[model samples]
Structures are given as C-alpha cells and as structure tokens.
Target: MSASRTERLLNLLIALLNTKYGLRRSELRQKVYHDTTSSEVAFGRMFERDKGELRAYGFDVETVTDKGWGSDDPATTRYRIGKESNRLPDVSLTPAECTVLILAAQLWEQAALGSAARNAVRKLQAAGGLVDPELPPGVQPRIRPAGQAFEDLVDAIHSQHPVTFSYLAGSTGQEEERTVEPWGLGSRFGQWYLVGHDRARSDKRFFRLSRFTSAVVVLEHQTFAPPSSFNVREQLAALPELPVRYAVVDVAAGALLGLRKHARAGGDADDTGAATPVPDCVDRLRVPYRDAETLAEELASYGPKAVVVAPPALHAAVRRRLAAAAAFAAAPFPPIDFPRSGPAKRTRKRTSEDQLKRMLQLVPFLVHNQGLHISEVAQRFGITRKELEDDLRILICSGLPEGYPDDLLDIRWDDDHVYIIQDLDLNRPVRFTVDEACALLTGLEALNGLPGLAEGGALESVTLKLMAAAGEEGLKAAAVAGPDVAPEDSAVLETAREAIRGGAQLRLSYLAPQRDAVSDRDVDPHRLYSLDSTWYLEAYCHSAQGLRNFRLDRIQSLQPNGRPVSSAVDPAGGFPVKLFTPNDDDAVVVLELTRQGAGLADDYYAERTAALPGGNHLAEVRFGSADWLPMFVAQHGGSVRILQPANLADATREWLDAALARYEDSTARQLD
Candidate 1:
C-alpha cells in the first residue's frame, strides 16, 4: 500500500496546477507518480483514486475534448485541473471586515442560502486573520426554504444524470414516479423548483421541491446530455400571458405616478397626457392588464383610494373576492388543529468522501449548544446519530502538524450528550469556494445598502476592507459591478432605518401602486429589506391602517412625524411580494435580433436564445402580459423584430404610435 494518499494527492495537485492547459493521463502518471505507470492497470487505478480524492476536496477536474471546440465526444476527452477553481487566494481580513462578514453569515442562518454562507465564514476563519468563537448577537435573520429534496436534485443537475422521484403531481394530486434528466434548478417567489426534461413524458417539466413525496434517487447508470440552448429562466417563462384589455379606473390625485411606476401592470396616460379628473377626489384613467387576479389584488391594497369602473368582468371579479373576504371575516369558525401523522424517515449517513465543511459547521454549533442530547444535535445538523458519531471520530483523529494526542481535537461524548472540552484551534478554517465568497459578498452589499449604523461608518468601507482581505485573484472571481444605489434612495433608507430603530413614526409621501396615486401617510417603520434589486420598507401605515410593504423608490418624500411609534412589527412577518413567476404554460415569443442587439445574446434569457449566422440572434423572450412584450420591444430601440405571435408586432406599433404622439405634444408645448 502507498505510504500516504495525502502526499501523492498533493504531488498530483502541484503537477496539474502548474500545467497551462492540462496533462494527458500518461503525462500525469509520468509526472506525479512514476512507479504507478509500471503497469497500465495500476496507473489507471491510481489515477482514478487521485481524481476522486481531488473532487472530494472541492476541486473539479474539467475535461476538454480533442475533437476541437464544439465536439461532444467523451472518448476524445482529456482532463485538467480547472485553474479558476483550483486556487484559493490568500485573504487577510481586518477585524471590522470580519465582523461584517460574520453579520452577513448570520443573516442567512438556517436558510437555503446558509450552506454557502456558513462555508464561506468557515473558510474565512480557516484563513486565520480575524477569529470569533461564535457569531455576534442581534443579527439573526433567516430566510429558510424547507426541503430535503433540494440537495438530491442539485446533485443530479450537476452530474447531468437522470433521477427518479415520486412527486405529488399538481394536476392529479397523487404521487407519481418521474424520471427526469435534470437540467437546472432555480428559486422564485420563495420556492425552489427543478426544471428538467421528463423522460417518461418526453417533455420539459418544472417540479416544485415541496411536491416531492419521496427522496430523489439519482440513477447512476443513466446520463443524458443537456441541450446547448437550455436556460432555466427561459423554461420558467412558459406561463400564459394576459390578453390585452383596457380598464377604466378612477384613482386619487398624484396616484397616477405610483401606477406609472409599475408600468408593467399597464400604465396608460389619457389624451391630455395626464390623468382624467373624476368626482370625489378620484381621477379617472385607463389601465391595461393581462392578469385580473394580480391587478385586483393590487387595487384592493389601495383600500378606498381607487375604484374599478369599466371592464365589468374585472370589476366584478375584484368586488367578488373582496366581498368573500369580508364575509369570511364576519363569520365565526372553530380552529381545528390537525395531528401530524407518520414516523420520521431515517437520516442517511455521511461517508468520508463528503465535503469536510459540514464537520466544521457542526463543531461550532455543538460548542455553542453544549449539553444538547446526541439525538438533538443530529436533528439540528440534519444528520443521523450514526453519521454524527462518525464525524466525531474523524474530528478526534484530526489535529495540528505533529498529529499528536494533545494537538488533536478533544471531543467528549456519550450516547446522551456530546461536548468539546479542549481549545478550538484544532479545526483549520476551510477556504471559501468562489460561489461561497460571492454569496457573502452579495450579502455584505445588501447590508451596505442600509443606513443608521453608528458603530461602522459606511457599508462601503467595510466592503473595501473585505476586498483587501480576499486578495487580487479573489476579487477577479467574486467582484460584481452591480447597479449603483441612488443617493436619494439611500437617504430614504437611512432615515427609515433610524425611524424603525427609534420606534418613531414617519410622515411619508408614498405612491400606492394599486391606487395609482400619491398620498401622505403616517407610518411606523418596522424594518427594511431588499428584493429584486430594490429596497423596501415594511411599516405599519396609519392611513390605510394596516401593515404595508413600500418600495423605497416610490417614496416621493419622507419626514419624521415626531410622534413615537406605537408598535414595531417583526421584520420577517410580512408576506413576500413576488415580482413575477414565470408559468410553464406561457406562450413563447421569438424575437429576431438585428446586428445591433446580437451581442446581447448572452445577456438575454439563456434557454430562449440561439445564435445565427452573420452575428444575428433569435431569442424566445418570455411574456405573460400583453403590456410587457410591446414595452420590451420598444426598449430595444428598433433593433429587434417580433417574429412570433403576430399580434405582438401590432401591439408594438400601437405602443410606438402612442409614444410618438406624446413626444410630438411635448415638442409643440416647448415651441409655444
């Protein structure tokens, strides 16, 4: 047997990383372990072991084909250590920067995003610059998406392997065995979905993670090639588009601006190029929409500020839903508590091949939650007791350079309780993967958006400190040039954050999107959150007399009302307003891009884009609203042609004509 697989693995890594392109199998054997190549069979076995070991340590050995750039043949494939993935830039984080990173990590605790965040923090700690035994207090906000199927689905998606899982079909409401070639995984509207090619039905399908009734079983023997043009976002855009229809509605003054802000919901100005004045403080206007349900919900949120007039169907639907809600509230019903049934499934044990980060995470958790029962700890970590025990054994055997008894981790445990009795320095901080670093960086960016922090100067300063720690190579991999936050928006965010912290009420001139009007309302700012690249203030509004979510961008003006707030709501209590959910049934509209827009092929929805000759491109952009398609086309500045859904082309022309009239009117006024 070889003396140490670790020594050989390190030698192999050095050889691979040093190479420019990659080494062939023969070249790898000759360079790394000359004795193994004495026989072809022995070399093959050694190479396989080394490759598997590398992958286990988080290195993906990418393969390149000999048949030129576009060839799909695996037989001609040669392997190389992916340069970007193979290296981890040395980071030296300042204490303040480490604190910021810690806060960022805490933000996603117990979240689907937590896995990446925790691992990144673990790596940062492993780098040995700033150290904290536990996360700081008062920074625990989690957005946890519950599911066990997500991991299995992700695994299948990565391996490009077909998986069989019993899914609770939405249409039938029964569990059915589905064999799908997993293509991509995405999250929208706070739910995870697996978009894949269903082999059983010979069609692409979206499987919600919550719908899985059984564990996803990856079929090891079956593998499939994903289409080159497959894009998860494009596939999700299949929902039905709303048909174009104009509805006459009456709204309060200044509400039109609010409505226009969400022009995607069909904001149309009247012939006067302004809102139509109506009776009783309401201004009449024509709004276009495809989705009656969503439009109704938006209008209802405005309370009595807006009224749906024409389009009897939409008016009736809104009235009916509102009436039913009132009736339900007026009626009394007994609360029934349903008992949970079925025994819990046994947890799967982890093998040595699993990433060691999980073990690192377990250490801190166990240390903090000391005296917890063994079973309790296992449940907390989402692992079986046997698996936890195995991790414990592994930790006990791991230590510093000498590999002696005192240098190793002193883990004390019994069947009932587990505890760590020695110094916490035994566990070397794990290096952050690129994705992990990006997640943490994005989180820091989110925190940086908030104002009213006294301890830290600006979030930007903290980010700079982190970037310095991450080194040059790390920045190249993780840095993103995101859209700049508007100065006014940032000011509003700061003021609102202060109001929330001080428990003070604010008099804010806010645009209610549903009402299509601006109104001054006294609000007790509760908390601030960002979604879809926009900051939102969740506050208790005194005007509508309810809790509402307000976009910071729509806030015209904000002033301190001077009155102390009566109550503060939990930051995570409000409903997550989904901006959009692409339905799998939406009509796909293909657009032929001119040379001007051809370069944007990569920027467009991935699954819907295809390259053509002469630097032209065709994209099947998703549109569920009659209003969205025309606007999308107009925004392209005449560089695109709507090829499918002939009706869309006509709609685009109508929108263009309307725009031209507005511009003509503006020019005439200027001349006068």
Candidate 2:
C-alpha cells in the first residue's frame, strides 16, 4: 500500500530529529522522499512543505550551513529540529493545581478549543503530573466560541495567515467583503470580536463575530506578521462605548412583563406628528436601547404582541424581522417522519490530521508509561487496539536516514503490554498550542469569579505557574482571547452556595417566567451550575415533587428555612446534560428549524431529528409545558416553526395573527 501523507510526515519528523549535524536536501530526499517523489523538484517541494507543516505543529526546524571550511554553499544548507526547543519544559504542579487545571480545561464544552484543552490535560496526565481531585458538584462552567468564524479566525491567527469574509457593517447595515490579517480574538461586553489589520482600509479594526455574514476563508500559503506588542484585551478595552437610544413599544397589558419591568410607562409622539395613544389592552413603554439589531431581535420575539410605536428605524427593523418570521412560519413544509426512537448518534470520520496529532502525543505518553497494557493505551487515546497497532506499525518503519534497525523506534507487545524501547528525543510532551493555553487561562480566570470553587488561592497560584511555564509569547498570544461570563448577583449566589454546603431546606420566592408569576416554594438544594452565563439551581421541589431547574436570577428571595433537608436524592447523579429534562407526561412538539435555528435542536434536547432540504431539519422535542411555545416561536423569529401537534401550532398562529392585526390597525390609524 502507498504511504499516506501522515505516514510520510511522521517519517520525515523522525528522520529530522534523529540527525546530529542535520540532514542536507539530497540526504532528506533519499531518506524521506525516496518512495513518494519522482524527481528532484518534487522532492524539494515536498520537503519544504513538510517542514512548514512540522513548524505549524509547533516544531521549530532549524536551518544550518557548514561554514567551518570557509566555503558557504546554498547546497550545504541542512534542516533539523532541536530537542530542547521542541520539548515542553518540566513544571511541578500539586494535586490541587492539577485539579484546577482539569476543571479549566473542561470549560470549553463544545467549542473548537475543547479538544485542544483535553489534549493539553492528557499530556499532563501522561507526564504523571496530574491527579484526579473531586470537583465542586454540579458546577460545570463552559464557554462557547461564537461559531465557525471564531474557530477559523483562531486557526488563522495561530498560522499568522490573512482571512477574508463578508462582514455586516454596524453603521451602514450592509455586508461588505473584508480581507484582514487576524491578530487576535477577544470577548468584551458579552460579545466576541476579532482584532485585526484590515487590508483594504489599511488600519487596525475590531469586528464582532456576530456581524460576520459569511464563512471566514483563511488564505493559506500566505502569511503576515502582526504587531509585536498587540494585545486583544487592550484593544477591546480601548473601544468607545456606543451611544444609547430609546424606542417606544406598545405591548399587551398583562403580557411581556419582563420587558415592561425594564421600560418606563410613557412613549414619544409617532412619525405622523401626533401623540401615540395606547390601544386598549396595550401598554406603551419607552425602553432604552444601545444596539438597534439587538433590540429588534428582542422585540420580534414578542411576535405580534409588541409593536414599536415611535422611532421609524426601530419600528421598521422590528417589522422586517417579524414579517420574515411570519412568512417562514406560514410557509408550507414537507411532513416529517415522527414518533421515532431518537436522533441517530453521528459517527465522526477519523482524518489523517487527527491521527497525526494523536501520534505526536502518543510517543511521549508511551515513553513515560512504559510496558502499559495495549488496551489501556487505546482507551486513553479514544481509539481501538487495531488502530493503535497500525500507528505503531507506521512508527516502527520510521527513523533516521541510516535505515538501520537501531535507527528506528523499537516497540514490543509480546504479552499484550506495549513498550517503546526507543523514542529518540520525542520523549517529552510538546508545548501547549495557543488555543489550549487560552482555553485553560481564560477558564481559570472565570473560576475566580465563581464563589465555591478555587479556594485557598489555588486559582491564582495555578495561573502564575501556567504563565511562567507558557513563556512570554505564548502568554501574549493567549491574552488575545477572553471568556465572557455575566457576573451573578454576589449576595444571592453566596446565599445559595451556603445553603447547598450546609445541606438545608430552603424556602424561596421564585418567579416562573413561563407562567409569569412569582410563587413561594420549599426545596432541598442539590447542585448549582451555569450554562451560557446563566446560573441554575437543580433542586428537589417539594411542590413539583420532582427535580426542577430554577434560574438564579429569577429567585425573588432566597433564605434557608432553618430546617434539615429530608430529600434523599443524590446530588451528583441528577445533574442534567441539558437544562430541561424530558418527562413522559411532557408534550412532544415537532419543529422545523431553518439553518439559522439548527442549534436550537441541541439547545432544546431534541429526541429525534432528520435533515431536510436547504439545511433545514425536523426535530421532535419535549416541552414540559406548551404555554411557552408561542413565545419560543416568536423569540427565535422565523428560524423555528411548529410542524406537529396541530393544536399547539394553531395556538401559536393565532397569537401571531392577533399581534399582526394589532400592528396593522395601528398602521391604519397612523395613515389616517
């Protein structure tokens, strides 16, 4: 069989590392490119490309020439990666430190950096520097990078490559093509932004990831150097605050109470030069807003119940979004196959890049854990024994250009125990990638704000240790990124933590948004966790007689009732993978999600899903109460539409129609 590029690269890496005086172009061609290349030009191109690939993987391949004879020739140029430069430096970490690091690494959740953080922790484990320590129960903090654009920009920044994308200009509200030398990505004011040098404008620009209108295209085979002292946080901090504006909206008297609470009870005159009279069963509100786009989305979610009365721009924006949503919801869709088992588990294809990354980490791991059982190694790397064996086979044939038995890596599995007899200079873990470092550091910083976690200055100590080990450049690059987590009310959060630690039954005044009512309930606190910056307490509600997740912000008043807890529920076992837990009695609602709303399938814990034409999907989801369905439909605009459970769909359509009719009546009055 022909050797794959991954195998060839591994062979080349092995050959380059094993050399003392470095290997010349001709020697590398003979050793690494013998079977792959047909001519000298092909060999040269392949070798150069491989060198860059290795460098991209964090290996610094040094170039040298023999000037000892006082005769410098371009042909004498040789290349090799020094062990000292490529290997990670030794750093001592306590069990507590390792535990904190693990927690930090696990914070990426579903972002692209999640895998990188895991890989970083695995390397630490392989080196025997990590220890398993008990984490705070139910406290899983996660940060999700905005989307595909964030991942692409991170990669581009790491490779120092330029990127091109279509960006929606905030001022003009039009999408324009932009080519930028991506310097760093950071989060500020609950949004992620890319700080880069705009090629067309010839100046530094900070772009919000949310404003991106198209997929980011990384210009490979081209690179540019960013400013030496560039820092993402500093750049973002220097940004000017946007001027705040006000919008007048007319909402139903009893509905949308949350919106009403934040707004004042008066409105300005309408565009027709007359005082806007509040319609019967409606309340006019003057709401302060900074971003029109954000406000439009929020208002559109109210569906037909809320209408902008003043500021033509705001009204037009809200109307446009609602019109789009109503059009999409009213559109006919193909019937979906329902009442199926569930969404089929997706199988990810193992790519060559993935294998290469695994092998690079595997070498140092096996070196540290000699004579480990073969199965254990496979399990650790999340691969099968056969795959591990194939990787071993490839490595065994890879070595120095000498082509001697001693030059190759020695391996044996005589008793189902794998051992690496020789690993050359690849016996130490590689340095952390930029993404991995940023994920860990940012997570650690976030942990500092969480009350119960990181006691005894462990978070700070760990941060110092990591910064010292990561060096200046790594630290600088990592600083280009930050996590955006909203600060929870400290007094309320501390009170909740105290209750959970003390194992007490708590009496609480909680506002249920779905029901739009505040009710007092007795509950035993189980665990406290946050998802997407919103803190939720999973508790055994005496009233509900089941596990219920209550948002911390909605707790009108929380104080322990000074009673011992009676619920014998296991706190560790009940932590949900998602916020909502489906019950048999819950209503099953089928939804058709546009490409924009596909993420809702995962967010809502869809039981079954099937892809439709044009990137739309049919999802079967469970709703504990159908009362919130109309608001859910409106909140997401046209992206989410009810397709099944005719009664619920009809109710939602009726609600939208009523809201739209109110707006039309108001428009007719204005025309008159």
Highest TM-score against the true fold, candidate:
2
Model 1 C-alpha lDDT per residue in residues 378-489, reported as the tens digit of each score:
7755567877787787666554323357655678886478888753332233345544654565567545443333256535665665555445323432222112122335
For residues 25-88, write the lDDT of model 2, one tens digit per residue.
7777767767453776766676778888899787889888777732235377888888776566
Off by over 4 Å in 1: 1-47, 55-95, 102-114, 125-257, 260-355, 360-390, 393-409, 414-426, 442-488, 508-521, 540-548, 554-557, 568-672
User: Top model by lDDT, which number?
Assistant: 2
Q: Candidate 1 — worst ten consecutive residues by lDDT sum?
A: 477-486
**Model 2 regions lying over 4 Å from their true place:** 1-3, 23-37, 63-79, 160-181, 197-205, 211-224, 242-245, 268-274, 330-350, 366-424, 452-457, 472-479, 484-486, 571-577, 585-630, 638-664
Clashing pairs in 2: 304-659
Q: How far is 456's C-alpha from truth in model 2 (Å)? A: 4.4
Per the 3 Å backbone cut-off, how many clashing residue pairs does candidate 2 have?
A: 1
* Local error of candidate 2 at residue 156 (angstroms): 3.6
